[model samples]
Target: MPRIGVTGHVRLAEGTAELVYAELVATLTAHGDGALHGVTCLADGADQLFARAVAALGGTYEVILPATDYRTVVGDRKTFDDLLGKAVHVDYAPFATSEPAAYFAASELLLRRVDHLVAVWDGQPSDVVSSTANVVRTARDHGLPVTVIWPAGARRA
Candidate 1:
């Protein structure tokens, strides 16, 4: 029963979401299934895709919102609301507002709590603190196993 956490680019190109979802399903399946729990921020792109895949597999989804006002900060209100509805548990960081700080705080908590990390990244350098690359690096630094999934021809938006 591995607790898998997710961090990824928010802007994905067309068709990438399906690819990511398939890959996540395969990976989650391989990890055995006593109790699969996925932790995510439920953002518009990869996070939401991972949540859906986890739920489809009969696993529990746990949401870690970046801030108190995450509903307003997140891109797609409908999707965020939908995913949040399915979450078994929802927690928020201490940050009262949203931005890079709140995002980083949420990422740190996700990395700290999960047994493994799934980074849906383009394998590119991240220019910001909360970028996928930075999150992957942080996970590795903490000696957490990371599964980096970037399907062939996948591009970020």
Candidate 2:
């Protein structure tokens, strides 16, 4: 099983989550070949969706938290707790707060550990240091295989 990681927008449109989740399952299924294992931060939107898809395939995943207080900042507290609880292993960045720097550190740690990256991005540019675009770019810069998934009608809210 490939150790897949994810980077994507944290705010998806109303129906975009479902579309993205379906595509993620397909992509992950193909890459996993049979058994599936993923690594994620369990943030809102794409991260949560990816975790759900992993579970649906009876796959296990590890959670890399940006900070110790990550749950306080995530959009969906319930979902975040649910996914975190399901994680086979959990690691935290060397930070006390969930700031951009902490997120960047977490993402970098995730990149170093995963064999491939799955980005649920819209191919946009962002100046934010911890944005999904930067993560995708960083993955590419490191010569990691990346699969960008943006289904039709997918939007960020």
Candidate 3:
């Protein structure tokens, strides 16, 4: 069983969700269907999409919250709750508050726990601390295999 983790932008342009989902399904399927596990933060855009794909393909979903009060920070409470409810395991970072540190901590935990990483990035550098590019670099530094997914017309908000 391979554990796949995801990191990507929270905002995506119109009509890109389907592309992201389809790419994820293809990527996960390539890994073979025997007990796949997906780890994600369940964030609005790419993270939530990846979780849905994992569930659709009979994989277990694991959620890692950046802080204890992650529900408040997540953009869509309904979607967050929906994914959280379906998660096989849920863990929170040691941080007490939701901040950049907490997000980085959660990212580190996600990268550390998974065997591979799936990054839904637009190939742009980010000024934010816990950007998808940063996570991909970290994963590569750790020797974890990475799959970057950016559809032809995909754009970030």
Candidate 4:
């Protein structure tokens, strides 16, 4: 199975973010067909969601951490174990630190390895930095398809 890269907004706090992530996990797992493609990525929001879901669904998963070392990146010992326990290694590279040009270059490398990009942007247009546009562009340049997921509109009561 081709790997699916997930990118999404990180504005959601503990409560709402957990619920949203749970749903996304379900969605991605349903989409994973196994054998043909296995899902994987960095261990963060959408990455965490997708990895956990894919593992539960019996699909192969890989972890792409943005730090030279897992312990350095994930201070939370438990979270680090959770992520490592489930994912396989695919090289380690820093993205936001003393270096930036290096980060973007590495981002391009990781993007090229995936088959599709699953973007989860918070529907707000004000977020210019981590906007879906950046992710979409990288994925397109790498010749991978994209699947975007935003918070579903508020439910009607």
lDDT of each: 0.89, 0.93, 0.89, 0.57
Q: Which of candidates 1 and 2 reaches a greater TM-score? A: 2
> Model 2, which residues run further than 4 Å from truth?
none
For each candidate in turn, the TM-score is 0.96, 0.98, 0.95, 0.71
* Tens digit per residue, CA lDDT, model 1, 29-141: 88766479999988778999999989989899799999998898778898789889999999998988888878988999998889999989889987798788889999999
Worst 10 residues of 1 by lDDT: 26-35
The residue-by-residue lDDT of candidate 4 on 1-157, one tens digit each, is 6576666553455555566566766666656555423344344455566666666666766655554544454335586577677666565555544133433444555676777777666544443433446666668766788776765652211
* Model 1 quality (TM-score): 0.96
Give stretches of model 1 more than 4 Å off: none
Poorest lDDT segment (10 consecutive residues) of candidate 4 = 96-105
For every model shown, the clashing-pair count is 0, 0, 0, 7
Candidate 1 structure lDDT:
0.89
How far in Å is the alpha carbon of 44 misplaced in model 3?
Answer: 1.5
What is the C-alpha local distance difference test score of candidate 4?
0.57
lDDT of 4 at 8: 58
Write candidate 3's Cα lDDT for 34-82 as tens digits: 6799999787899999999999999998999999888988888987898
Look at candidate 3 and give me any clashing residue pairs.
none
Model 4 residue pairs with clashes: 1-35, 1-36, 1-37, 1-38, 2-37, 7-120, 8-120
